[model samples]
Target: MIPEELLLKYTAETKRFQKDEIIFSEKQTAHYYYQIVSGVVKMNNFNDDGKEFIQGVFYKNQSFGEPPLFIDVKYPANAVAISDSTVLALSKSNLFKLLQDNPETHLKITQSLAKRLYYKAIIASEISSQEPAHRVLRFIDYLKDDVYKVEGKYSFKVAYTRQQMADILGLRVETVIRVIKSLEKKGDVKISKRKVYR
Candidate 1:
């Protein structure tokens, strides 16, 4: 991610978006580089049958929709605020200028994008051949270890709702609920007060 000071130097503007608001839509021109300053955002798409498929959920300090900016292509998914959120938006031209002037920051951005690609690969494999319980467990484990960096079993609290998990994993909401409860019975996760911990 580009530092805020640098983004500001490149004329990045702070913008606020409300929950369920569409920040940018699929097929829209990639005009700005978006970085979340507060709250949650999701890049998602809807199927013809009205099923929602979440491409990814982004939290504070994370950047989304970068590939399109670098390649000069339209965004393939819509960016929406999951909660009332604050974001920094920089023009595509300004982002290129900032990167060109800052080699270290550019490298960091590349690494961030690489991690996203890696996560996508893992999800693809999990969705294809894994059983329901295994898929959910693996996804939660990845979030705990790599994304949240929390240690110890059942020490990390899962913040994503069951519906969100189902959307991302390509499972039905009922399946996600059942799998989580099954996981709890098996001692793979701990559920208390309806929140899952792992």
Candidate 2:
């Protein structure tokens, strides 16, 4: 992610958003490079019947909704504050200038986008052909092996709620609950004090 000082140097504004506020909607122009200063944000889309599909979740220090800046396309999903949050937003032109002035930062942004693309490809495959149990387990494994880098059994505490998991994985909430219980029985995960660990 771009450093805070660099963002400030580029005249990035620190904006605050309340919980559930829409930062930008789907098809809106991608005029800013946003980095989280606090709290959580999610990029998502809703279906005709109002079912939510989470594209990604970002926490403090992470960047979201930048892929469109590189592609010159409008945002494909809406960015919303999951909690009251502060974010730094740099105009697209300012971002270009900052990147031109810092080749290393440009490379870093490219690498970050590539990783997200890789994750999308992996999840897309899972949603397309995998069973509910397999999708749930693989998603957990992705977080364990890639995101958190935790290895030992039940060492990673899951932070997402069942409904959030269902949205992200394109499954029903009931399915996620059942899958978690099934994973527990299969020794694939551990549920303790109503918290899940993997």
Candidate 3:
């Protein structure tokens, strides 16, 4: 990730977005480099039947929607605030120049993007071939590190809602609810005050 100082130097201002607000829509021109300073963001799209598909979710200190900027392509999905959020928005050209000046940061960005590509490939296969339980488990496992910082007993909270989980895993929300309840009954996860722990 780009350092805060460097980002600040390039970012003219911090943009604030309310929960559920659209930062940018699908097919919009890619113009800025965005880094989350607080809260969460999700890049997603709707299908023909209006079903949502979540492409990615990012939290504080993370970045999103950079691939299109590099490729000079329109955004493939909409970026929305998952909560009240602040984002540092830099001109794409300035970001590119900054990366050019700092090869180390550029290399880190490359590695990060590559890791995301690999994750997408794995998720695509799971969505196409896995059962609901399998898909749910796989998706949770994928986000385990992000959602939880396990120290002793595998206890961790799920960062997303059931509907968000369904969108990410390509399952119906009802199916996600049933599978989670089943998981809880089977002792695969624990639900405490609506928070899930594994």
Cα lDDT of candidate 1 equals 0.94
Which parts of model 2 are misplaced by more than 4 Å?
none
Better of 1 and 2 by TM-score: 1
Give stretches of model 3 more than 4 Å off. Answer: 145-152
What TM-score goes with each of the models? Answer: 0.96, 0.95, 0.93
Each prediction's whole-model lDDT (CA): 0.94, 0.93, 0.87
RMSD after CA superposition, every candidate: 1.0, 1.2, 1.8
Q: Which candidate leads the pack in lDDT?
A: 1
After superposing candidate 1, which stretches have Cα over 4 Å from the reference?
none
lDDT of 2: 0.93
- Candidate 2 vs 3: which has more TM-score: 2
Q: Rank the candidates by lDDT, best first.
A: 1, 2, 3
**Which is the winner by lDDT between candidate 1 and candidate 2?**
1
What is the C-alpha lDDT profile of model 2 across 111-184, one tens digit per residue? Answer: 88888888899999999999999999898888888876898989999888889889999999999999999999
Worst lDDT run of 10 residues, candidate 3, spans 145-154
